[model samples]
Target: MSVCRQAARQWSPFSLGNMPLYRVCGIFALLSVGLISFTPPCDGGNILVFPVDGSHWINMKILLEELHARGHTMTVIRASTSWYIPEKSPLFTSITIELDEALEDFFELYLQEHMRLQREGGSAFAFFKITKDFMSMLSTAHLMWSEALGKILDDKTMIKSLMDSQYDVLLTDPAMAPGVLLAKYLKLPLVLNVRWITSGEGHFAIAPTPLSYIPVPGSGLTDKMTFMQRIKNLFFYSTVVIQQKFMVGPHYDAICDKYFEGGCDVISLLQEADIWLFRSDYVFEFPRPTMPNIVYIGGFQCKPAQPLPADLEEFVQSAGEHGVIIMTLGTLVNALPKEVTDEIASVFAKLPQKVIWRHKGERPSTLGNNTLIVDWMPQKDLLGHPQTKVFIAHGGTNGVQEAIYYGVPVLGIPLFFDQFDNLLRLQERGAAKIIQLGEVNEHRLEQELKELLFEKCYRENIQRLSRLHRDQPITPMDQAIFWVEFVMRHKGAPHLRTEAYKMPWYSYYNVDVLLVLLTAVAVSLYSVFVLVRCLCCRSRRKPKTKQH
Candidate 1:
């Protein structure tokens, strides 16, 4: 700098050397060229996705989008009767399969009946009835998937083509098992985008889940269980076992026999997955044992709020100090039963706060001027909004995760499946309240809403959760993407997966070893005892002679 100053003083024209912008541009250009020259280009991997329809497809689609953005080629296998998974998409090329039966009505009926039984207070008769219904539903769904996959397998051309594609990893949600079966048939590395599987939650399938803490889905129990709670957990677990062995297993068993050299095990296949992008997090989920390959990417689908449409903004602004309450029952059921909706609507009508409800059913007569009923609302955007106060939810994983992400306290009306369990976790932490379907009346719902709205603790606790959830070193989405890429970079992640799944039950638990050791010790003791007795007898026999 001193030399430059001296030169500047000697020649005024030389002062143009102070033009650092030109120098900065030259340096930036050099760095850019260097980076371009040295940095290895992205080698896109081929990914095959087999996703279940409905909300499961939604999750798979998001993951596919991220993989697509990262330059990976994606192909999604969807069903012909799928209501949600679009045949045409910019994200991935979809291969639609033909289905003999459509399952939308079947699931809808099951949910309706389940909700009705829950509303009937879940009596013993109701419990049995619901169990029968669930099994029937489970059987039909699996049988459909099994047959669909059989058709695909029978088509030599399609099977050959999929194998020819040489996909790096086969990504699937194990809610149904065709994908796992297909992956095995194709000999591709498998990655599961999962929470629910055929049997129960994915954790129960792969992790060492003890009923002492890990509550079964639909069992409104938490990690800290009372004695009776443990029994209830077992009972719920029994339901899951019945679900697996009786309802879901036989259909897949047939498929396993048909294609696999030996009978295939869906649960075992699930355990063999290279990576499990589990849709849960410790921040939201109760602490439990997790496998190495299981990546908790909870709330990954949630993003920052975007601008609301004009009318929504105006309605939200109109709420002012009272703020708005938003309600949505995830993807499956657009509306609850008439009586339940009426009860909820009546409560919302009386509230000072404005309400935006995503209800597709007939409008309630009790719906008030303060409430706005729409077919759909931008859920995450509303949750992120400053004016949004409380979220009324059906306790879907996505909704509960989003609630945690946005720090919104929930007033949950869990209808079926894992909904109650999801809300139970939030309630255990005092971040939310659950009102069961049986007890959902105007008086009860109104009371719950008032408490959720007025209570400071609920807001504070959930916000604390939000902070912890946001405090991660890497975002959940990025972590998920990294593991997926990690699996692709290395053909499969067998090192991360446990070999215990391959072991027989006795071997896995070391029962055989324990029995062998026990037998050796017992035989040694018995032999020593017999020898000592003989020695004593000999001594006794000789003692008479010695005394003489």
Candidate 2:
């Protein structure tokens, strides 16, 4: 059994005060010692990282390089995904293959199946059922990916390839739950690095409460269940939980059994990590509720400002002081409908200032001389340029962070998911204006861009937040490194963990306890009142009879 399981079994509800405190402390202390002993000093050493290839992987690359420069020997396990390019640099000590051709083929098949289902017409009920099934299949695919990763770690030949490398710490993205298993199997301290707002709390470090359990922040919307949405959110939560339970739980168990000779809960396995690091500034994600183990190290991915390419810089500078507008929809969702693109192009054609759009394909022939389209651009370099006035973006977290980092006002055309939330937050902070994806037209785009270019307050507001962000005691990277090292040195600090796990659903909200107490008091008072009434009636009847 894992240490957490042992502690849970030993814990007594009635004798909470007289529990074996020393043993608990001893176990935690020993774990802490083991973690710290394995952790190299702040100077950095061998660190093994698992690769999750995507646009977000870019951030990890910067982080790895920063640690490498500080003397860390960085090794990466390359997962074959189109999102990551393994040949980008020679920083990795060794790249281990984690994906098989069969799995890749299966994933492609599943994707095609789901896409076909989406394209086919069906009844409303059928559509809902199909979507749910699709989500389930996608979740299973993710689980399969996690299991495959675990199998790779379990392989003796694979272990031989990695074990000879003499790595110190294992760092990974939290989404890859397999990382937690690998860390446990290797008995290495794990550092969970989150790239976006994850927990329910927007920015507060409080324990996660369900979205329905509290009012949705900023929107003033109470998740008061309207029978339907409640059921939907519940279903959503259940689907996610079930997926995690099946995928993460078994993989964790298998890894533990193979490596640690023990069994453990997936949650405990995750929480057993030394530290949880968030790559976000508190100002942007304020009111976020998280566990004590969680730390905010936002902007760690941000680097010192770099100059733009000479020709591009010259073109932007020569825009005759009106300055150029920088627009990008980010990497994943670049393929906007032709109508949307035409509308965007139409708006840009009329603008006096030059427009530099990071479009994926060929520039439209109708676009004016002032407009430039490129397949890719150095985003940060462009953002930092003084001649760059307004930003039109898809409102990605990294883009939002960069905009705030440089104090550039944004015109956000949020596409989906947290992009909406990020845009909402930016608008609430007076740092940007939002144009819904569905509502984007030439008129709307032109008007919003005009307002953003002319608005002084927007620029000022972003600058204010930028100042606040920069005023942090240390850079996010330093803070992340500190906590990561802290966890390794201290072992797992259970003391820092909150009582969230111990509380029942009703008790967590104090609803059941309050209801029970109220019911008991009401019942007791009613019984007493009834008894008094009976006595009075009997006394009155006796008096009346005597008089008669």
Candidate 3:
């Protein structure tokens, strides 16, 4: 037979038109799905972002840029209180508002107080003192924004423009409560970005937090707590709630009343938010209660390190087989006291591993020849490098997430804010050592670094966490984008939201259930007592009748 006839004979039964009607429909359906699978998603919408300016911006920058890349239009409201960089992309819009000087003073004072506390050996009262200072700082920041908020609302032209923007969703950081009000003003679905690992009110807004295991942020307590520690944790959360109610709540309400249309309370408004994106992952954290609205996009902020510049590459490569240690206190901590800096340098000099310290001021005299000091370093690159063995960090969320992403053990020199709490949690994970700046001496620094560098357990634990962190089927970026779009596609993700939004505190906590149970027990006890008394009376009456 000819080649054409043989081919026709072999394929005749599978020909599309020659097949049954149902089979033809199935074949076309398969083709349709294949075409749709490769097709890019196009359901983009206007997304308004409100990230607190200055260092807070860095936390959300990667996610914001990724949103823009995925074709969502973003409008950012930047405050002049901190540094604001206009996004280079055309898809982004920036509106700068002049903020009060209170924020700047707050940070300066915070650093001074933090250093003083660290220098003084920690006491039983340390947690109380630190919590008070942190709350005070937060209060000061809110007052500054309150001043700027009045101006923002007074600007009729700007208000008119923003109102007309017709944004589909409002994304705001938990640090920026004004952003919550802005969402209400725009009448858009509110999505929160909790940049910190734990925010008291933020978690409470989503679901009830059990303090037994979930350490209070900034409490200087870990996930594994003794009975005393749990009591302390309870006290920490109680104090936080009290402060939020008395101090932070009023400020937020006042701002919302002035700016938002409906003028709801901050807590109530927060509950109605569509989704909460936390800067935390389960691998580095204890398993805790979470609702469908909660999503952990922890390492989403971290990216593959770009190629290091020529000088940096040469310096890191020079370490050879010994590897390098990247030490950075992050952008917020611009400089440390010279004495403390000298202590760190002294320890670095003795180690065989090379040190790349990110410091702005003049180099310390005790710094070794193996050490490389720079005004700025590629922190992510250095941490991600194959030869990068350990990271000496301030335990900031950004730095810690990067270390976890790359499976590098950390020698944490905690200063202030959540740094102490972060290191405490990581220490519980067995992948980090917390070196309080106050107690940091030559011996402590040298000993801690040696343990972190040489210890097999540290590396093994971190590597285990690294695998879990990286073993996700979907990239963090994809997961984040998927949820964001899921919200948009489904119109604020009502299905994913919890009934906690609708329930009162008493009902949600099952106080009503407890009350009912108590009532039922009381009724049952009364019935039993009556029956026993009646039986005793009947027995006594029978004896009297027999005597008669």
Candidate 4:
């Protein structure tokens, strides 16, 4: 049969008219039941995804794909960043803001000024001042992005347009705090997907309690902080609280009042979120104490192996027995100081292994025979290859996950941010050694390389962790999809929420104990005073009676 004729015969309602009326009605009923069965329970619902670029969004893409496969729809709203290379798809529609362009321009101007100052032989004090100024500028740029996002969200027309679509769930990066308000206003299920670790305040509604708590995973050592450290931590938390209150809290409150009947607390809005998803694995971010509503669905960004590029394949093929060392500092911190680059080159020169370093822009002059510099690399593919042995990395979470996925040991040279914490976790797990940025000399680099290359324990430990990581009942992607669907199926699982949301800070910390002690002391002092007064009165009454 011709294709069109076959489709017509299958779908034509007029053809069914020839049958008995009862038979036609039964056919229509059966068709309706089939249609309902095929359709997903949810409608053409929407999801608002922010920071829609980078590895963070990769997992989100996977979830969207799953939902799409199941016959649902989503809309992504995000800031533009180069990290997210666009893949053309009809199912996905993206709304991107130009925040990255502004940030790029600001950083370039700041860099040019700082470089000029350095070229002018600026003093140490002057250099410090310039650095501080640059940091302030960066912070200001971040704040501006947040404010612009807030303005977009606050527009009545924009909110109504988005609401008209009747979105079922709002998924946002924890870095974008404005999402909480949008979710609250719409009265939708807000799922905060945390891409990185931070205090559970601000955008990180899914993180563990004691919001700013840092876990020293696998350390197997827990001790109380010294008094000074406790004081310092308290001061740091207070500062963060103050900054976030001004920058995010007030705007959040305003948005909530306009949308939520002017009757909601900002923190209550976050606490009432439908669910929280973290991108960290339990093995990596172990010892995390989170409520039932918070789910750890890490490694969703990881993928099975793919074929390596021809040039990379040939490069590895050329390196016979010594194998290859892959080095990267991630995408953001591409600019390494000249001293560090030179030291890395020197160490690579001494090693027998062939080194492939992903260095952007101009190459250093110290290139040696066994070394090759490339602007980029297939990091996971290389890690999976048998010829690839060691990863010298900056300890970014994605890089670390890839290394662990392939069971390749790492020599971490962490520079800043969570790099230190990641390296510490790896070191505790006995799968890696760290080279602090300040101490990245040729000697130390060489020694660390030697240990990673020759040490059997590092390899064994990594392989062990890889086994644990892989032994899960489902892939991280499957687990993530399940939880996301669970939320949709259940219509917001408020029962998973904890009592932490109800208590004040003082009460949560048992400051009520101090209050009780103080009250007892006051009562004791008052009793003593009453007793003394009674004795004085008795003495005075006795003297009066004697006189009479």
Candidate 5:
């Protein structure tokens, strides 16, 4: 509960030393006036947010609450597919809608197939097989979500109410086509809540992603690529571009057509986005060209470490000089193969350091006295603890950023998706080490853990990174809030929008410029050669006509 709510619940004349009723009421009135003074200006307009109904919702929560606290009337249109719900606040309201039944069913089937393939030792063929199915699932779900959103928009009364509300801005997750389409219909300035640093297909639509250095998120390549590695990265990046263009783009375009009259392309809305608040920072990410509209809110979800529960604190301190290691694979990954978990437990038992593994499944029999198996652990709090020696993780963007914030060196065991790329980059930066799941074994896990724990270099690198992350003039969250209101304050801040969004693909890449330069050089070379040949022929003819 908020402080205001707590005070209201405890407020009473009797509690105030038996003061006169009028005096108590006067004190209450003064407190109320103070609270009113703290409230944001009444002129703050409504801001509507539409987030995809999974982990993406978790990513948007902090920013949403901050906006509400600043006196903006915020409404979030939620989908029924969410695994968790945000805490109820009087300042923010939510409207829930169910996804298509077929989508729900397909998602279950897709999850099963995906997990099955991932567990079967992620071979090259397994990678392709899972990628194909995941793409198909994405297309089907996107279409169904679009249809579900169309129904909501088709409701005459809802449309009337939305139009009447006069919402000033629409913030949305770029992955959701429905949200983008709705923002267009409402004719509000759009802001994207991109919750990851790695450049994905959706991000490619809004900004220029150079293929030379920036590797695709899921591709198992680092920024510093050899010639062959560069070619491989290029192929991988190009394939994603093609898939988004030929496959995802057309489906979303059709979705827009259903409700948007003459219709619109999804990329059109992305191009018009006033700001792209990325969950990224330069400290962790490779240096890349960024536009003015891009805002980095990397550690917005992180906060100062609070006191741990007594039991956890006692357990952590029991390790003494050895310290503690926190291991978690993030929210989506709940289980590993029992054999793999057993091997991990075996590895943990041999280590001198105490281990806290956040396992969501049945505990393995190989568990050690030094290891504590918990269904869920406060990950950030554990990492922030001074006794923390190392962090073993799946190398998620959030997890990696947290490790950096707390100065914990990571031993990444990447399973799938962007985990590989994230870990690879960290390894390149000397702050972390990677142990691929396919290569994970007792020996490997133990070896990497030892390196991560005892190595002065690893700790030094992360501490340096921590300094860089903290040395910013303003906190990332405050910077994000400033820019969010900056958009509204300046009516979309048109000056911040880059000219890159307005250019065609060929023009943006300077293909036309290259073509013109090549053409001019070729023409000039040909003319010079022809002129020389003519001069030679004329000289030969003059010699034949004279003293021959």
Candidate 6:
């Protein structure tokens, strides 16, 4: 039935125009290389997935695809208002919960406003405004998600169905923590496909982060910090803590109180996870303390390059020796501010390289014939291409990982959120250069672009990273799968999970131990002082007796 088998059965060597033995051997080589595939057998397991609806879903979907190929059944819980998480898919069965309105469009409206504020910002007042606006938006998003989660809980039939399904594991993105709640409620082994947790970066929730060295996400500092920078990092970290404690925590508190016996705190629940498939590697991330259960499976989504489409191939080939430059701002943003785009486009026009930019909205007036603008691109393939010289991007996790995978240097234009932090990692490694939106102009863009392109260090550094990433004993994807299935093989991995979450804050930090030790030391010191005083008094009394 197979092509190789069919060719073998036909026995066409004599019929093929008197072919030589070497040509016949070449046919066998083709069969061995192309027609043979060794697919490992799989044990089909049921997996329940809860994913956030935007860029987070992309990673979740890729993981699900791999699991599905390995004979796993998947069920996804999504919102009716979700544009990205469709109601139907071949890979997973969907359970769509209705929402009052689409949240994705709501987020985009605010994204535009944030970009506008960032462009206009020059003073402390402007920074305060951005932080205020972001917190308001975050609270609203949490409020909506919490309400939607409440709907799922209130449904008796749906609850019964989920319980009856008896899923082996619940795979979730913890950015939106309803999945975590569901996993706990169902008592399934929780495996998080995570980068961001409920309040901030995932590490802070589960790992012991020393503020002395490990920089906070938005502080824009590296592992090595100055005195003032350490103070600034602490301040930034406090804001994240306050957000989780005061603002976002309250949104879910009501639900937890009503549903669970012991009222659940989401952060603690997150720390109790059986496995955290963290979406970062130390090669790309700053070195920090990590837990036993946390698996580093960064760049799991990347793979070898695929052939380019005919038209795109022709365009790339036209660049010849100068090579091509690829620029994209990720899924959330369609376009940058007009002035910024005009500046970037103008600079691209002046360069000798070919450009492929993924952009929407108004085309820049200064567009060049060398540059091609499209609504979408085969991002990974483009990065993998030999002709791709440098990447100009927004510094999302996916894009950054891909750039590292393919050994491409970047000139980053970080707009908002963790984009700056993500890009800063590469800049620290000397693989990228960053230009802010507020600072963008023809001169800055041209200078950075040329530096990234012509400077041999940028290319060399990223390539070295690529080697480090590739030299692992096992692939990241395989490592992730092994862990996921390991969870399934054992009902849970509580052995690896630390009991640190259950301990009180005082006990966890050893404040109680410190207090006991301090008290004992003080008591011993006081006794020694009293004995010494008595001895001195006796000596004085002896002298008085002798004089009498």
| lDDT leader | 6
lDDT of 6 by residue, 286-314 (tens): 98999999999999999999999999999
lDDT of 5 by residue, 492-528 (tens): 8678877775678799789999999999999999999
After superposition, candidate 6 runs with Cα above 4 Å error:
1-42, 531-548
Tell me the TM-score of each prediction against the true structure: 0.93, 0.73, 0.86, 0.77, 0.85, 0.91
| Clash count in backbone of candidate 6 | 0
The per-residue C-alpha lDDT of model 4 at residue 290 equals: 64
Off by over 4 Å in 4: 1-45, 52-55, 62-71, 80-91, 98-101, 107-138, 195-239, 246-268, 286-288, 506-548
Worst 10 residues of 6 by lDDT: 34-43
Query: Model 2 over residues 484-530: C-alpha lDDT tens digits?
Result: 56654565455776665556668878999899999999999999999
Candidate 1 pairs with clashing backbones = none
Error of 5 at 260 (Å): 2.9
Task: State each candidate's clash count.
Answer: 0, 15, 1, 0, 0, 0
* Per-residue alpha-carbon lDDT of candidate 1 for residues 1-548, written as tens digits (9 for 90 to 100): 59997876656532445655667578778989999999988789999999988877777777888889999999999998998998998988989999987789778878888888888896899988887887788788889999999999999999889988889999999999999999899988888899999978899988888889888887878788899999999998998988899789889998888788978878888888999999999998888888889999998998899999999999999999999999999899888889888988898989999999999998898889999999888999999999999999999899999999999999998877788889988998999998888999999998889999998999999999999999989898998899988888888899999988999999988999999999999999999999999999998888443553
Better of 1 and 6 by lDDT: 6
In candidate 4, the residue pairs with backbone N, CA or C atoms under 3 Å apart (3 or more residues apart, or in different chains) clash, namely none
C-alpha lDDT of candidate 6 relative to the true structure: 0.92
The lDDT per prediction is 0.89, 0.68, 0.79, 0.69, 0.79, 0.92
Candidate 2: count of backbone clashes, pairs at least 3 residues apart or interchain: 15
The clash number for model 5 is 0
